[model samples]
Target: MKEIYLVGGAVRDKLLGYPYSEKDWVVVGATPEEMESEGYRPVGKDFPVFLHPETGEEYALARTERKTAPGYSGFVFHTSPDITLKEDLLRRDLTINAIAEDCQGNIFDPYGGRQDLQSRILRHVSDAFSEDPVRVLRVARFAARYHHLGFTLAEETRQLMSSMVQEGEVSHLVPERVWKETERALREPSPHIFVEVLRQCGALAVIMPELDNLFGVPQPKQHHPEVDCGLHCLMALEQARQLSEDSEVLFAALVHDLGKAETPTEELPRHIGHESRSLPLIETLCDRLGVPKKHRELALSVARDHTNCHRAMELRPTTLMQLMQRLDGFRRPQHLEQFLLACEADAKGRTGLEQHPYPQREYVLQALVACNRIQARDVMEEGITGKAIGEALTRKRVSALKQFKQQFTTQDKTQ
Candidate 1:
C-alpha cells in the first residue's frame, strides 16, 4: 500500500499560481529498507527521508512527531509503514503547508488547508503547533512571503502564538533558527510584514527585543509623521525593498533608527545622540544572531553615517572625503551604493513623504565619481613618495570633491 504524493511548499505554491523551484514528496506505508531496495537514497538524519534516484528531490516518509522536551530540537519522530498521510500532515506548522497532491493530480487536504489558502489565511494546523518554537518564525516568514497576495494570520493562530510566548515556548528558539527564518523573510517582497506579524504575536519581544522596544517610542512628528519609531522602521524597510533587492541594504534600513529606542526621556522626541547609541545595539544584535559580516558592516555604516548621507549637500569636501574613507568607499564603491540606498530609504519612509525627492543619493554618487577620477597612480606619478604620498592623495581627492561641489552648486543656482 505504498503511495507517493507531492507535499509542502511546491504543492501550496502550485495551487496559488506562485512560481516555486523545488518539490518535496511524502511516502506513505514505506520503510527505509523498502526505499533503499527501490533505489532511493537514505538522507534523513532524524527521521525516514530519501532522495529520488533520478531527480534528486527529497522524499520523506509519512511520520508523526512527539514533544519530548523544550525547543525545536526536542521532538522525537515516529515513522512506520502504518503511519498515515493525515497523521503526517497534522504535525505540520501551518494549514496551507499540510495539503498534499498525488501523481494523479488528486489533492488530499484533511486539514482544511485548501479552504484556508483560498480565504487568504495563515492558520496553524493544530494546537500541537505550539510544541516547536520555530513555527513562530515560520508563520512570520509565510506572512511576509504572501503579504502581497492579501494573506493574513488567522486571529486564532495569533492568539495561540501569543499563548506560546506567554508560556515561554518562544524563548526556546536558538539564535540560528531565528536568523535563518529572518534572513529568508528579509528576501520576501514585504519583509516588514514578517516583523509586524512577529510583533503582533508577541514573538518579537522574545526574539528581537531591541526591535520590539521601538514600538511605543515616539519621534518628532514634523520630521517623522509616522511618529512611532517602530512604524517608521517598518516603513523604511518597505522603502528599501522599493529601492534595491539587496537584503543587506534592507536590513540596514530596518535598523537605522534603532538607537532612538534608547533616547533618554529628557530628550523626548529629538533623539539627538541616538546615532552613536545605535552602533552598540547593532553590534550586540549582530553578534547574538550570527549575522553575516557583510550585513553587519553595512548596518554599522548606515547606523553611523546615514545622517551625514542625508546632509550630503552641506558637508564640506574634507568631511566628505573622510566619510568615503570610513565607508571604505574608495576601494569598495558598491558598498557606498548600499549605504546610500539605505539612507535614502530612511529619509523617505516617513508618512506623507514616500515620493519626496532625495537628491542627496545622486549627489553622493557624483562626489564618489569625482574622487575616483583622481587615481592614486596619477598622484604617485606627480613625483610624490613615502608617507606623504597618502597625505598628498587625500588632498587631491578633497580638491576634486571641492570642485564637484562647486559645479553642483552652480547647476543648482541655474535652476
Candidate 2:
C-alpha cells in the first residue's frame, strides 16, 4: 500500500489559509525503486527524496534522526519502511510545522500541532529541537513573520533555545547559515522581533555580539526618547518597515546606529561623531557574515552620512553636492533613495516621533535633481577644455543647487 502525506509548511499554511510557496510530502512505506518506477526523479543523497513527474513537488521518505554529535550537521538519520510519519514528525523543529495532511484531506497531528497553531504559539516538537542550533534562528524568524498574527514563542520553546545558547550550540552555527536566517528575518513584517527573540534566548551574544552590546548603551533623551540604543534600533527597523520593503533599507536601519555602543562611558547620553565610528563596525560585520554587496554598501552609506541627510535643509549647496558625491548619487540614485529612507527611519525612530514627517528626504532629493540639471555635456558645450571644464561644471552645478535651495525656501514660505 502507498501512503503519502502533505507535510511541513504546506499543511500548516493550508490550515491557516495562508499561501505557501511550495509543497513537501512524506512518503511512508514506499521503496526507492517503486518511486522511480512511478516517474519520481531521484534527488536525495542523505535520504530518499524524489520529484513528482507532473507537479515537481518534493517527496521524501519518512525519516527519523538522532544526535550523533554537535551542530546541525551531526544528525544521524534513519529511513526505512518501518519509520512512521509520527517518528518523522517528532524530528521536526516546531509543532506547527510537524502536522501532516493526507490525500483524502484528513489531518494527522499526533503531537498537538493543531492545538499549538490555533493558540498561535510556536512550540518545540521535542527535546531534539535543541539539537539543531539553526532551529533557534528558525523559531525567531517565525516570530518575526507571524508577529502580526499574534504568534509568539512558547515558554518551553524559549527555555530550550536559551539552554541551547548556554550549551554553546549556537557558537557552532556557520556564518552562511546565520546570514541566511538573518537576511530572511530582515524581510519579515516585524524584523525587530527577530532580533528581540534572539537576544531574549541569548543567541544574539553568540551569533552577533556586536549587536548584543548595543542593548544598554545610552542615548540623548531629547533626540531619542527611547533612551536605549538597542530599543532605538528596533524602533528604526519598525520605521523602515513602514517606509520601504527593500531589505537593504531594513538592514541599514538595523545596523546604522551600532556605533553608539562604542561611545565612551564618560560621554553618556551624547553620541557625537558616532557616524564615523559606525564605518569600521559595519565593515567588520559584513566581512564576518559575508553580507551581500548591496546591503553592505547601503549600510555603510547610512552609517557614514545619515547625519548629513537629516540636516538636508540647513546644508550649503556645496556641502549638499559633496554629500551626493559621497553616496555616488549620480551613478546610483536608487541607493541614494534607500539611504534617505534609512535616514528617515533613524530620525523618526524616537519614542514620540514615529509618525513624524521627514521632509529632509525630499529636500536632498531636490538638490540631486538640481545637480543633475547641470549636465556635463551641457557644461562641455560651453567651450572649455582640460581641468577648466571640470571646474566650470562644478561651478554651474553649485549655482543650480543654490537656486534650487532658494526656490525650496520660497515654496515653504508660501505654503
Candidate 3:
C-alpha cells in the first residue's frame, strides 16, 4: 500500500495565505499495528489515532466506509489496505475542507472541491451531510469566517440543513458541541453571516431559543433605526466584531439585551433590569453548554456588571473602591481591559439613542487605572493581612483612603 498524502486544511489555509495551525495528518497506508511498528504510539481508545515519535504530531489512521447508523453518532468503519485518499476526502463536511494536497503538493479535486473553493461556495460533500447534525453548525461558522470570501451555502445543502432541523436531528447534538460552534462563530470577524445562516436554517431555535424570541420583535423607531430587535442585535454584534472584543465578551454582548425580547413592553419599549435578568439566564445557558466555570463567571460578570457602569460613575471614590474591593481583589491589567471592552460594547450597542449617563469613557478608564494603582500598590502590598485591611478600612483608615483617592483624582484632573 502506498502512503498517499491527503493534507487538508493546512493546504487550503496556505493557499488562502492564512496561518496554518494544528496540522492533522491522516495516514491511509498504515494500520494500527503498522503505525505502532513505525514507532507511532496509539493515543485514542475508541478510535485508531497515533502520535509520530519524532514530531509528536497526532495522526489518525482512519478508514473510509458508508454510515450504517442513522445519525452522525452512528458510523461504521472499514480499515483496509484498499482505502484511498480520494475516498477519505469525500466524507468531509464541506467542499472547501475536502480538497487535499499530495506529497509533491499536487492538488486533488475529485469532487470539484477546488471549483467550490474558487467560487467560495460551501457545498456539502454529499447528501449524507444530514447524517451529522454538527455539520449544520459547521456551515454557519464557515459562513461567518469566509463571508468576505463570498461563500454561500449551496441550495441542496441548505435544504438538507432545513430538513435536519425539522427532523429533530439537532437535538442529537450535545450542548458542548453546539456551544463550541456558537462561540467560535460569535468570535468570527463577522458573526452576521453565522446569525443569518441560523435564521435561514431554523437552527437558532434549537441552539439559542432566547435569540429566537428576537425574530420580528419590534424595537422603538427613534433609537433603533433597524426596527426589529433581532436585526438590532445583528447590528450590535457587527459593531462588537469591529471592536475586536473577546469571544466571551462578544457572546455576552449578543445576549445581554435578550431579555428585552421576553419582557413586556409598550410603544416606548423598555427592558428594565434586562442586564440582571440576563445574568442568570446566561449562567444557565453557559452551564448547559458546558462552558468553563471561569469563562462563565467572566461572561456573567460582564453581563451583570455591565449595567453598573453608569451607576459606578456617579458614586464617590470611596464607594467605587468599596465596590472594586467587593470584586475580591482580583486585580489584573487583563481583567481591567476586558471590563473596558465590555463597557465599550454596551455603549456601542446603545448608539443612536439618548446619551449615556456615565462619566466620559476616557474619565472612567483613568479612574479604573487609578483605582488599580491604589489597590495594587497600597491595598495589595500592605503586608497587613486581609483581616487587618478589613479592620483598618472599617475603623480608622476608610475615610482617609477615600480622602486620598479624592485628592488623587482632583490632582489628576488638574494635571
Candidate 4:
C-alpha cells in the first residue's frame, strides 16, 4: 500500500522540539496518476509535487536527483514508484535533514540522522551532496540558524565542501539563488556563522569575492579592536542584530567596511575615505544578487554615510542636514534609523566595546528629529517661490539643527 511520510525539516524540527514552520511530505510508492486521482494539485515543474486538496501542504513523490550539468540548473531528477524512502533521503544534502516520520509517527532515519541530531552535528548524507553547488550555501545557512544550538559541521563534510569549492562548484551557482540563501542567513540571530563557514570552505571567494578579500585587511586597533576587516564585518553583524531586527540593516552592517579592504596598503590601518569608496562594491553586490530595493537602498546609504553617522557629534549643522538630505531621511525617517543602527553596529563591534554606550546614536537621532521639524509648506508661506523655496527651506532646517546642536552643547557644559 502507498504511504505518506512527513519529511525534511518537519521531521528534524519535531525531533529537536524546534516547532515546525512548514511541513513537507513524501509519498512512497505513489504515482502522478494516483496522486491526481486523489485530487492533489500538481505544482512542481521539475519533479512530481502535489498540493493537498484540503491543507495545501506540499507533498512530493519519493525521488532521487543526479548531476547532469555544472550549476544549480544542472540537476536531473528521477521520480518513480520504484524509488524507496531511503533512496529519496539519501539524495538529500544533510543527514539530519534526510529523516522522515510516517503517518504512524515512525521515523525513517536510515542514515544516522537522529544520532547526528543528538550530537548537534551537521553531516552530509552521501557523496551526492557535492553534486549540487547550492548545498554549500544551504549548509552555511543551517549553520547560521543552528549555531546557537551548538551544531558543528562534521570534519568529513567540511572536507567535502572544501573540495567542492576548490573544484569551482561555488562559482557555478546563480547570483539570485545565492542571494536568496544569503538574505535568509542575514536575518538569523547569528548570521556571522554563515559568512565564517563559507569563508572556511572557500565558497566566499567564489560567491562573494569582495567580502572574502576583507579577511586579512587591518583597521586601526583603537577604533576596531577586532583588527581584521572580515572579523569586524561579522562583529558588526552581531551588533546589528542587537540594534535592529531589519535584515536590510544587518546586511548594511556586514558590507559597511567593504571599502576598507580596498584602502591603499601604503596607508595601512587607517581607512581614509573608505565610506564613499564602498558605494561601487555595494552596487556591484546588489546588482549581482538582484537584492530587493529596500535592502539595496539601506545598504547604499550606510555605505556612503556610515562614517558621517559615526562622527555625528562633530558634524556642523549644515553638514548634518546635508547628510540627512543625502540619505532621504526627511521623507523616510526609517532610513536614518537604519543607517544609525549600522553605524552603531560598527562602533560597538570591536573588542571590549560590546556593552559600551554609543552616544552618537542619540545625537544623530536627535538631529533627525530637529530637522524633521522644518516643513516645506512653512517655508513656502514665507513668500519663497520656485527653487528659492527649496533653498529657503533648507536654510530653515539647518538653522533648526544648529539650535538643536547648541542645546546639546549647553547641556554638556551644565553637566
Candidate 5:
C-alpha cells in the first residue's frame, strides 16, 4: 500500500502559482529494498532518499525526526513503512512547505499550509522547528524571495526564531551552510529584507556580528541621510539590485562600509579612515564564513577602494593608473565592471539620493579605456626588452590618461 506524493517546494509553489525549478516526492509505506528493486538509486547517507530512475527527481521516504541533541545535525530520523504522510509533514520547517499533492492532484495538507499560503504568511509547521538552526536562515531567505508579494513572517514564528537565537541555537550553524544561504539570498529580488529578518529575530548578531554591529552606528547625515551604517548598507544592497543581479557585486555593496562600525567616538559623524579599517573586518568575516574566493576578492576591493572610485574625476592620471593596476583592470575588465557597480550603489544608496547621478563610473571607465588603449606591444616595439619595458608601459599609460582627462575637462567646460 505504497503512495507517492509531490511535496515541499514543488507543491507550495504550485499552490501559489509561482514558478518552481525542481520536484521532490515523499514515498509512504516503502522500504529501501522496495525502492532499489524498482530501479531507484540510493543517495541519502543518513536517511532513505532515492532518485527516480526515469525522471531523476528525488523521492525520500516518509520519516519522522526527533532531536538527539542540539543544532541542525542533532536530529535522528525514523523511517518506518508505517510513517503516515501527516507524521512526515509534521517534521517540515514551515507550514507552506509541508503541503503535498498526490499523482491525481489531490491536495493533502494535514497542516494549514494552504490557508497560510493564501494569507501570505510564513509560519512554522510545528514546535519541532526549534530543533534545527538552518531554518532561521531559510525563513529569512524566503522573506527575501517573496518580499515583493507581501509575504510576512507569522508573529509566533518570529518569536520562536528569536528564542532560538537567544538559546544560542544559531551559533551552531556551519560556515558552509551560512555562506550558501547568504549567497542565495544575495540573488533574491529584495535581498536586504533577508538581513532585516535576521536582525529582527536576533540571528544576525550570532551569524554575522560584523554586520549586526553596524545597526546603531552613526554616519554623517549630509553624506548619508539614512544616518545608521546598517541602514545605508542595506540601502546600498537595494541600489545594487537595480544595477546588477550578480551576487558578487551585491555582496560587495552590502559590506563595503563595515569599517564604519569600528570608528572611534571622536570620529562620530565622520569615518576618516573607515575604508582601510573595513579591509581586515571584511577579511575576518570572509575567512570565518568560508566565503568563496571571487566574493571575498570583490568585497575586499569595494571596501578598500569605493571612496577612491567615487572620486575618480579628482584623481591624477598617475594615481588613476595605479588604481587600475591595483584592480588588474586591463586583465580583468569584467571584475572592474563589478567594482564600479558596487561603488555606484554605495554612492546612490543614501536617503534622498536614490536617483542621484554618479559620473565617477563613466570617469573611471573612460580612464581605463585611455590606459588600455596604450598597448604593451606598442611599448615593447621600442626595443626596451626588460624591466624598462614595464616602466615604459606605465609611463605611456599615465601619459595617455592625462591627455584623456584634459579632453574630458575641455568637453565638460564646453557643455
Candidate 6:
C-alpha cells in the first residue's frame, strides 16, 4: 500500500516508444489528507488532485468511486486508505491508458491493456467511457496519432461515442476544452481521423453548424470531380493538417471557405467573397475556443488575404510597398515561408482557379526578401512613414515601380 505508480499516458506512451516525460502518479495508500501530510498541495479545483512541492509533479490519490450523475459531469469521487492502484486504473478512459508502471519499471495490466496496445486498438476500460463525451475527442486524437501505428477504435467504444452524441452529451463540454482537444487533433500527423470521428459521432454539427450545410452541396463537375463542397473542404483541411500543426493556421484553413456552403452557385461553384464572409465566424469560433487575440488576428488575416495573393501580382510598386508596410515589416524568412505555405495550401486545395502562374506570390516573396536585405526598417527610421512614402511617389513613379526598372524611374527609388 506504500507503493505509488505511474499510470495513463506516461505508461502508454512509454510502450509506444514516444517520449514520456510528464508523469502522473497515483498513490495507492494515500488520501488527500495523507498527501497533505507529506507536504503535497491540493490543486485540483475541478477534481480531487494534488501536486508535490519539490518536483511539481501531480499526484492523484487512489480512489474507488461510483457515478451520481448519468454522464461525466455526474461523478461522485471517494478516496480511501484501503483502495488499491488497480481500482484507479479501472476508472480511466481507455485500456491503453489504464495500464500502470511502478518506480522499478514493473507494469500492471489488469484489463488486457498490453494486448490491446499490441493489437493497436483503443478500447474503453469500462462502460464509464460513455459517461464522458470528451472521450470521443480523445479517441479521435488517439486515432490520428496511432493511425500509422495501425490503431483502430474498438467496436464498443465507437458505439458508445455515437450514443453519447445522439444523447447530446456534447453540450456538456465547454467551448475552450473542446477547442483545445480539436486543435490538438488538428496538429497531429493526420487530422482526417478527427474529422471522420466528428462526422460519425455528430459532434461536428454541434460546434460547427455551418459545416453541416455543406454535406450534399455539389460542386461544378468540370473542376471538382470530388463532387461536393464538404468533400473539397475535407481535402483542404487534410492538406492543412499535413502542412502544419500551427493551431491558428490550421483552424483558419479548416473554416476559410465556410461561406461557400451558403454562397455556392452554378457559374462560380465556390462562392466568391467567401473568405471575407468567413472572418467573423472564424473570429467567433476562435474566441469560443479561447485562442489568443494575436493568433485570432493572424488567422483572420490569412483568411481575408487568401484571395489577395493573385491581386498582389498586379500591384504597382507604391501599392506593393503599401502592402509590405501593412504587414509591419514582417521581414523574417520564416514569416514569408509561413504565409506562402498557407497561400499555397489554400490555392492547391481549390479547383478551376486560373492556371496563371502565381507571379504575385513570387514577387511579394522576392520583395519581402529585398525588404529584409535593405533593412526596410532603416528606411522607416529615415523619417519615412508609410503615408509619407506613399505621398512621395508620383503616378509615374508608381507605374515605373510596377514595371521593370528603367533608369528614368530610378529617381523615385530613393526615400
In terms of lDDT, the best-performing candidate is 5
Task: Provide the overall lDDT of each model, using Cα atoms, as 2-decimal numbers.
Answer: 0.93, 0.91, 0.70, 0.90, 0.94, 0.71
Count of clashing residue pairs in every prediction: 0, 0, 0, 0, 0, 0
Model 5, 332-386: lDDT tens digits are: 9989999999999999999999999999998888888888887879988888787
Residue 71 alpha-carbon offset, candidate 1, angstroms: 0.2
Give the runs in model 5 whose Cα sits over 4 Å from its true position. Answer: none
Off-target runs (Cα >4 Å) in candidate 1 are none
Q: Cα lDDT for residue 106, model 3?
A: 83
lDDT tens readout by residue for model 2, 33-81: 9999999999988778999999999999999887888886887778888
Q: Estimate candidate 6's RMSD in Å.
A: 5.1
Task: Return the lDDT, model 4, position 82.
Answer: 93
Q: Flag the better candidate by lDDT, 1 or 4.
A: 1
Question: Residue 147 CA error for candidate 4 (Å)?
Answer: 0.4
lDDT of 5 at 116: 92
lDDT (10s digit) by residue, model 1, range 26-55:
999988999999999999899978999999
Give the per-residue lDDT of model 3 (tens digit) for 249-308: 677567666666766666326566766767767777777788766667667666666656
After TM-score superposition, the amount by which residue 234's alpha carbon in candidate 2 deviates from its true location, in angstroms, is 0.6
Cα lDDT for residue 200, model 3?
A: 92
Error of 2 at 368 (Å): 1.4
User: Over the stretch 373-414, how does candidate 6's per-residue lDDT look in tens digits?
Assistant: 444354566687776654543333344445443432464366
Per-residue alpha-carbon lDDT of model 4 for 1-415, expressed as tens digits? 6989999998998999886689899999999999999999999999999999999999999998888999888988999999999998999999999999988989899999999999999999999999999999999999988999999999999999999999888888999999999989988768999999999999998888888999999988878887999999999999998887789999999998789889998999899999888889988988888989999898888888887887888999899889888888888888888888888998889898999889998887888888777788998787788999888989998999989999999998999
What TM-score does each of the candidates earn?
0.98, 0.98, 0.84, 0.97, 0.98, 0.83
lDDT ranking from best to worst? Answer: 5, 1, 2, 4, 6, 3
